[model samples]
Target: MDTFHFHLHGDVQPLDRFFQNCIGSCHAYLTLREDWREHARLIQREIGFRAVRSHGIFHDLVGIYQIPWGGERVFNFQNLDKIYDFWLSIGLKPFVELSFTPRALASGDRTVFHYQANVTPPKDRGEWELLIRTFATHLIERYGLEEVQTWYFEVWNEPDLQGIFWTGSMEEYFDLYALTARTLKAVHPSLKVGGPATSRNMWVKEMLDYCAAHNVPIDFLSTHHYCADAAFEMGEFSGIHWRGQKAMLHDVQRTVQTVRQSAFPNLPVLYTEWNVSPIHEDVYGKDSEFTAAFVLQTVKDLSGLLEAYSYWAISDVFEESGPGLTPFSGKYGLVNLHGIKKPVYHAFHFLSQLYDEELVSDAPSLRVTRSPEGNVRLLTWNFVEPVNPDFHSDYPLSGGEREEEIVLEGLQGEYEITCYQVDREHGNAFRAWLAMGSPQYLTAAQVEQLKQTAEPSVCDHQRLILDGTLRIKHVLPPSGIRFYDIRRVG
Candidate 1:
């Protein structure tokens, strides 16, 4: 192992907490479920994400648009109101994804997800426009115009996936977006709307061009990206090394450059969805401690490059293809189905505790910040990107032993030092579940055990005196994440 040194000077700058701007949920219909609400409330209370985004807002299951047998078209928002109201009650706004066409208005029976969200474009453009108007009108009527103005009405999810998420061509999506954006604006001029929510950062420039040419209103440029997308872009299925572990960061850098050079240079860029991999069964990344480092590394690297980078989801109450076969199945969520907080959950929680002022540090992996109350906080991670990425493999992501030494040469003082950490041995629920014989299903007692085991370790709590200099050394395991809270003891 080699030691890396950092001299903290207490120099600070204002920081933007962009990571918590929004969080991704499974879908709109799932919001009605009790488990989903519980997860939403927990994430809101702990991480305090500003808004929640999901697919299938207009799915038939949500019961938004309906045409009864031998009857006329009708729009109902009672159920939608419940979902939105719950989000507001918990200090969250909706990052509304106007999605999967309702069966009544869908051009075809085509659908996606196990919940079968209709993916086709509207059969009748007029009817679709009417639905969009009614949806926006009902929201404003319920939540008030002032409150609704804070929400974002994203046009659709991954329209560039074509047959999978959209049965329409690029031109057709542009038409739908134009009509929907126009309709939402007509409902209330102050309401915000934007789109081209395509995966792999596709169709952004084209969408912007189309919107500009057609005089369409687009308030922001929204898209999705994952580490796997970077890998795919590099034409590598066996592995990804675009910039070693910084592949995702490089991907965002390129996208940001593209947006900056485009006609919509000042447009708010939102990566509405992102994660280590897009695979639902990605055990190596999603289910292990690897995700904590992956998250911390990406968030640090993408500080000012993006407005919002929403992680794929907050909980494993997801059912895109169906339910997970086992308790620890590689579902893309920060918390597992039983509500056990994964390493990624604690990663966000650690970030939430950071103060607004960031202290300058020499290391790329270390972040130092000071609170108004005089407490100093440090976040550091050891990220080990996988080689020949294999999601199904049970192999651990730990690469090698790494060490760091820090010499603080600021004022001499007594301080209380506290630390929280998540690595293979700490805050990793999957490993604990595996230790319990990797049960296919969990009992209430087993669930409780896992929850307790999944908590990030709190260690190094002590009062120490710094005499002109304080030297600290750390030997971090691969994919490890740690946060330190230091408060001056007067």
Candidate 2:
């Protein structure tokens, strides 16, 4: 049994900005798929993510470049328009990863992903600059300067991951970033541009130094972090290992601190890509109670440290390693291919319901907030790092459930308490799927049933008359989260 105390007081701090409102995907060009579009709309309507960030916007599949009979290259925005229109219609602005060199502009044959995005730098810097300038101008003219100014133009995705995402050296990446930044800024000085969107928090200080030395504009700093211990190399799944939550928190904190200590101290930091594990094939890691707990823990730890943080993806319509056939195949998405919500999705949904007003709690596992109307909310989780033998345990809740007694003082009135919980037995569709024999393919009715059961379960409402002290008891399982909303009664 663990006892915790929350002291509700008038003193308050502004809630951290919803930095997690941005989410990423490998299917940026899949906006044409009806199911994909529906999934995007559902995520927007439910979770209300503000921006969608993804790669492949400049890939040949989108048909952005053409070499005419005159041996001159022309850039087209017809497909780009369709993609942006779909996003805007769903109320999602583009975070805009300007990436994957179009084949005509590419310097070499290097490529990555199922669709084979060109990983090479442009053969000619000036031509690349023209392409960027033309694209930026088109966006500004179509969306209006004021509207486009709000969008983010991340120069490239993980340029530091040489030989995989980029075929250039670190110096070359710096040059590319500088050229891209200068070009985008040239189009409209107000256009927000930033990056070196590196994985595992690489290149923050060096990027700042390069931009400062070269006199290039950097509106924000961007990078990524995952809970895995090391970077993922192609064909290296067997070597993957969990680094635990503490390491992930330390990495993020250090990354933010690095940017803050740099010459551009005021620059906002956006973690454009992040997840519990970078190894996409680790099915259990992606679709488990541990991931949900990791989500709650990560957000709680990194809340005020960055301007924006995007989970690696919104849906599993991804195709970096090709589309996953199984529903719960350890893909990097909040929702599966069938559009069923995972535990991590429910974690964000719970977090979205919290009020901005602050309430004090010393426990690391708990977040307490007080509404301006005097309502109180407490979100707590029991998190166990998925490592070794612990990872082999099918149901994390089996022996790890613990009783928690929460005591709130300085309360003088009657209140109603509503508890929303997500654990192995609640708000976990993957676990339910396992119970149903881990079906490789599910019928429509089965899918609907799982969808209905994939939400956070609400406990029976409890009303309490408090004189001066309030105490409530809850049993929480390992990798479980509970959000308690307390409303003062009239």
- The TM-score between candidate 1 and the true structure equals 0.95
Q: What's the distance in Å from true for residue 411, model 1?
A: 4.1
lDDT per residue as tens, model 2, 394-440: 42233477688988877778899898888889988999999999888
The global C-alpha lDDT for each of the candidates, from Candidate 1 onward, is: 0.82, 0.83
Model 1 CA lDDT for position 127: 90
For residue 252, give model 2's deviation from the true position in Å.
2.0
State the weakest 10-residue window (summed lDDT) of model 1: 233-242
Give the per-residue lDDT digits (tens) of candidate 1, residues 311-411: 88988899996988888788988888888898889989999988899876557788877777666788888887666655676544437757877565663
TM-score of model number 2: 0.94
Candidate 2 worst ten-residue window by lDDT: 389-398
lDDT of 2: 0.83
TM-score of each: 0.95, 0.94
Prediction RMSDs, each to the true structure: 2.7, 2.3
